[model samples]
Target: MLYIGLYLVAAGVGGIKGSLPTHGAEQFDESTPQGRIKRSTFFNYFVVCLSAGGLIATTFVVWIEDNKGWKWGFLISTMAMLLSIPVFLLGSGFYRNKIPNGSPFTTISKVLLAAIINSCSGKTTSNAVVNMATSPPSVSTQKSSDTKSKKGQEKTSENESLETQTQSFKFLNRAVNNTPVYTALKCTTKQVEEVKVVLKLFPIFASTIILNCCLAQLSTFSVQQAASMDTNLGSLKIPAASLPVFPIVIIMVVAPIYDHLIIPFAREITKRETGISHLQRIGTGLVLSVLAMAAAALVEVKRKNVAIKHDLVDSTKPLPITFFWIAIQYALLGSADLFTLAGMLEFFFTEAPSSMRSLATSLSWASLAIGYYLSSVIVSIVNEATSRGHHKGWLSGGNLNRYRLERFYWLLCVLGGVNFLNYLFWACRYKYRSTGSKK
Candidate 1:
């Protein structure tokens, strides 16, 4: 987990650092029609390919894990990362351009907005469900047949159905081929190129905050929770690390529902031409995070009280009769993920400049670094101070055995609240700039 976290930090920072304009002038605009079209194509290809690669790579890792130890798996992953460097650096030269001197906050704003959009897309599922529930029912009764020959009428209906199918396929192809990033990539100007790079990197960099917070919890507090509780699934006793599996399983089930049933409904009812924006989805994730922490806090409170009753000894194992805390953590985290992760993918791919889409994905992973640092700082201060005297407060000595983790989790709830509020303030103020727009 630590290695993965470090890797995320490295890649995310590199992406952010690399996206800066290397030259100082704007070179292209929507008026440059041919140039914009090519650039857009490049962007589309970059996003689709990069996303596919990551998906493939992750699947391979999972596959190898069952047959081989982590050492071999890491070795292969490291090799893949090393192999990709040359290509990224080669692409970087094409992407580099200069930025005008202005507020550093512009860069910050860009990152924040990118993050917000990604989050909005992430909430596609919830939005879909809401829309589905409210939509008017469809009337499917067939009209009485006209007096023409039944065979002729049947042939006409079949032709109509075939034409509809053909149109649907064509529409899907157009959607894939006509993205802005793809259009931008074929362009020659530096300005258009720079814009493309920004779109590519923004989603990844922005996502790091939430991702780090989430992924880190899987190995740490989550593990501790399992260890302190009775983890029996039927007759099988599970390991602490296995706790993450529950959330992963939930994700698998929920993902299909969101993609097939929710997103399309949301796009239709919200009157949002592109469905909910990424930022809105991320905001929903932040809200779910608050609930997840609250659940953890409740569990901690229960554990703490139990410890006090059992005399707080390391050897005196106070078994929690129920493993409902585990369920809460899994459910809350799972729901949060449905919004944030998917949105981040779409957000980074759409916003990133044409040449550096992979870097954008890396940036999303990097948010874990920031969240980890924050979690670490909070834990250190609380634990160190508590250990100084006889009292552990929330984290000291054996208090956690008493389920004091609840307090720490509550603190996270507070942090999530603040994060969400700040996010909302920024999102409302942001003005989106479409790539190649005249103004």
Candidate 2:
């Protein structure tokens, strides 16, 4: 029953996270400059609003679980979940609905299969030559080709203006043939274009998983680290679980300042609609994640030293160090999240084809989810690699004081640094589809 309920909750959370943000963003018009600006603001506040709920959970809900009981915590969660239904329904009338054509996976699969089948025939058709061309064609050829390939040309107002986006993935352009090798393998220009957008965004999506891997530590090992520290605040004890409040508060405070003050100032200097480019914002977050890991390592070193000084290294008792020490990493990761998450949401949504915006935006959370899973895998791999011939693994020790946590943090820091370099390689080369973000 417990497992079932957990799975149910996960399903519900996934649905809400994927759908809600896309729906809110659809409310804003992205067709005009003002509308696009307003849409960007919506993504910012979306993070702020999520942080608000987190603020309550980390403080109020966490306190209840610490002092009162776990049952009360569950009860409060149930009530909140029940209450949110009506609140969401109340805004339905004013909401703009984006009706999906079908599952995006189907389109992706069709395009891939078409590209494969059409290319396998080994026919270098005129359409393939046109799409795979490295340089612009002569004026005579352009006019003649346009007349011949009238069907492939997008005449719709939305797709007509951006015909050049499909040029990057030339192989897939074969999928758009009028007379495909197989009838089922035929695709449209919009389909090939959308698939190319998804493929191009892949590297950026994978790069942020390492940052999420760092973030996963906050809930697991970071809390355990706090559990070994002094959690007292003016005679009022605080729970280690509630330590997340530090980051939550930071997000709530910093998000608004970035949107209101920081953005306007940036717009003045850059004269760009999006004050900071999405890739720049994501890169900033990646850099901070590297710093966060380094800070965590340093803090771990400081913590271990204090434990040894007090002769508490072999014991489980709380050391003289304050729980606020753990807040250093939390604060950094929080700020990283503020930049990366908002940037990713906007980058993925604005840059994606209109049909796939919801799916693209959902990739942000998918990266986070994969990161959480990856954290555990990393720990397991570390344990296996270090446990050699009767030597206990760095993180295998039951006592937090006895663990070589600093070494583990150092490993993450190094990985994050490498990931940032990888991100720079791709981000520098990435072409922005949006006019507001054109570099």
Please give the lDDT score for candidate 1.
0.53
Q: After superposition, how far is residue 343 of candidate 1 from its true place, in Å?
A: 1.2
Maximum-lDDT candidate: 2
- Score candidate 2 by lDDT: 0.86
RMSD of 1: 17.1
- In every candidate, how many clashes are there? 51, 0
152-214 per-residue lDDT for model 2 (tens digits): 432233364334335677888777777878877677676777888888898999999999999
Where does candidate 1 have its weakest 10-residue lDDT segment? Answer: 124-133
lDDT of each candidate versus the true structure:
0.53, 0.86
On TM-score, the candidate that comes out on top is: 2
Kindly provide the TM-score of model 1 when superposed on the true structure, using C-alpha atoms.
Answer: 0.56
